[model samples]
Target: MSPKYDDVRNSLLGWLSTGLREEPSTAAIFHQLCHRLVDYGFCLSRSTLHLRVHHPQWLGTRIIWVRDQPHADEQTVAYDVEATDVFQRSPFHRVIHTGKQVRQRILIFGPHIFQIYEELREQGHTDYSAWPLDHSQGRRHLITFATDRSEGFYDDEIALISDILPLFSLVTEIRLKNQLARTLLQTYVGPHASEQILDGATTRGSGVTVSAAVMMCDLRNFTQMAARRPRDEVIAILNDYFDLIAEPIERHGGEILKFIGDGLLSVFPLDRPDACDRLMAAVTEAYDALARRSPLDHQIRFGTGVHVGEVMYGNVGSTRRLDFTVIGPAVNLASRLEGMTKTLQRPVLISGDFVKAANCASRTEYLGNHGIPGFDDLMEVYALRIDAELHAR
Candidate 1:
């Protein structure tokens, strides 16, 4: 390692490791890259350090492009890349497809909105170089370093990055791919005005899900709360509440199906035999969450209902807008158990079906059968511990 390369060793290594680890957040990684680039003589008048982030979506077949902070131009860096005319072309596509370094220069003769060339020309930036980073998960990215040097990318400059490009490319690809999944989630799964906020609201039916254990959690007092609060506050509260339910779902190998106002509809499907066990863990988690979530202290407190049952999994909706949710008795039982929370007076309630399958006795108390709403026969249910008692044997 030569002295010139030594200046960027820490930054380059950090980026490489971050790429490998696929750190959920790239802000800190890119922020560090910006400072490190400055240390390595990438001093341009405008925001010189820029990153092109991309990932694969639509089942690892379609590529999605994204951009991260520290823009090349302060005025236009944070603008949407999809809205840019540059994205209309296949420049990024070609680079990712070939897995090679590529450079593109767009010259605008007339007045334009984001005159980056004009800004660079005024600031004396004439030359640029870039390398592609492709992760094995069908994700590709470009780590482009631009300089104002009239001579363009020098031999040593190109060689230095090229030498480490292989390692950086491997991790960069993963980082960007994971980033792509997240970007898609934030765009599609998030509560955006245009987006439906459901995970599989768009196209579905591409993948097959084996038998899965379905769990549904319906929030109590949501209807009353929504009626009392402002409209904007309702959305804000739902977003915060969903965060609580979602983190555990993902950790326990579950997917959030939808948010019916204050309640969260979720599923835990199992290809493995142990799939039913997650119900116990999730039940305990829900109770613990309730115990910690004091309305006076946190402004939000709600009960959780859980049940386990077998069901088929697939995309369920019309051609225009399809959704991914479970279809079976399991989902209904989960909902019934969730509603029982109000009558049971416990923050978390589980169905008898879940308790029998739980196979872990002494962890829960069987609540006798009782007539439930919309049900002809009385439903049998059970209640988990309030706190300090583990659901799993």
Candidate 2:
């Protein structure tokens, strides 16, 4: 390589090394790298980085950088995107699936060329090339470059980019893996629990005892709905129900620990003075939302049980498969109360402990102490007054 080219390569390598140490996001790295290449006299008008990620809702993401733009644009690709004809005919699909580079000059395109090539030609781009970006464990992604210059990229420019791609891939993979870890953790577990696990709290039985308002929510008649409806329809109904119930809990600063089939377990840790009050607010909002959906063809109905007590919150289960959750008499009491909602014909049941902690005795209707399974003594329970006038308070 010429001296000038060698200097450019070294400078770009140093920048990539600094980016790795700084841990900037993948999009930032792509934007800076594209600008740096342009500054180094490369005929680059646009660049894109396509990365497949491990996510429950998305298949991958595309980061697009245009010359003179202040920032790159990131677009998520859904799981079913690959099945489309546009994807199958694009250069990205060829490069990703074949693990090979695709170089085409727009001026000499054939009739059977992909629609993207035709679009690029219309947009004044003269050349386009895509290459597989290989990462660890044989994972392959994609990188593409396009130029509007009539002469396209010089051979030396392409060679230099090829030489530096390994370093770029290494830096990006680290950030992508870290991002994937956080995404998956937050998806399966709640954000609070995910943060704890990420901050070196992974050992089995490693946890802390915390005073919290525990809430358990279960969908009413879910078994009958699932058995009667189509599998896909049942899943859709469940998702809709969860969205309605989980939003209020999360908005009130509660962390949902588990989604057990047709139910969920959550807690509002008493770190703040109004923890129990917040739990009540969440319960009220959830009930109201469910009520609003009564006019729908398939309305969703659920029961919620609330209590306040100290519980152990942390990892528990088999050595290989540990679960980060809460467990104690408090959680059991909450579960039992949820079950009692069916017999009591109430949508919400609050234990006496929760009512006392929340300081809302005047707003609740006291139900006499009732016999609870597995407990020697009867537990006092209360029901929220669902009247609009009282709930307005």
| Residue 276 lDDT, candidate 2, scale 0-100 | 90
Candidate 2 versus the native: TM-score?
Answer: 0.89
Best by TM-score: 2
lDDT of 1 at 143: 57
Candidate 2, residue 182: the lDDT equals: 92
Segments of candidate 1 deviating more than 4 angstroms: 1-143, 146-210, 293-295, 372-379, 388-393
lDDT, candidate 2, 1-393, per-residue tens = 888999999999988877457755888888888988988888799888999996787999999898887889999899998899999888878998899889988875565378888888887888898988899998999999999999887787788888899999998899889988999999998899999999988999999999999999898888999999999999998998888889998898999899999999999999976889888888888877766554644767788888999999999989899999999999999999999988887777889988888999887889889988877899999988774322111
After the best TM-score superposition of candidate 2, give how far the Cα of residue 266 lies from its true spot, in angstroms. 0.7
TM-score of each: 0.52, 0.89
Write the residue-wise lDDT of candidate 1 on 141-177 in tens digits: 5555555655655566566667766775554455555
> Would you list the C-alpha lDDT of every candidate in the order shown?
0.57, 0.87
Model 2 ranges with Cα > 4 A deviation:
17-19, 108-112, 226-230, 294-296, 387-393
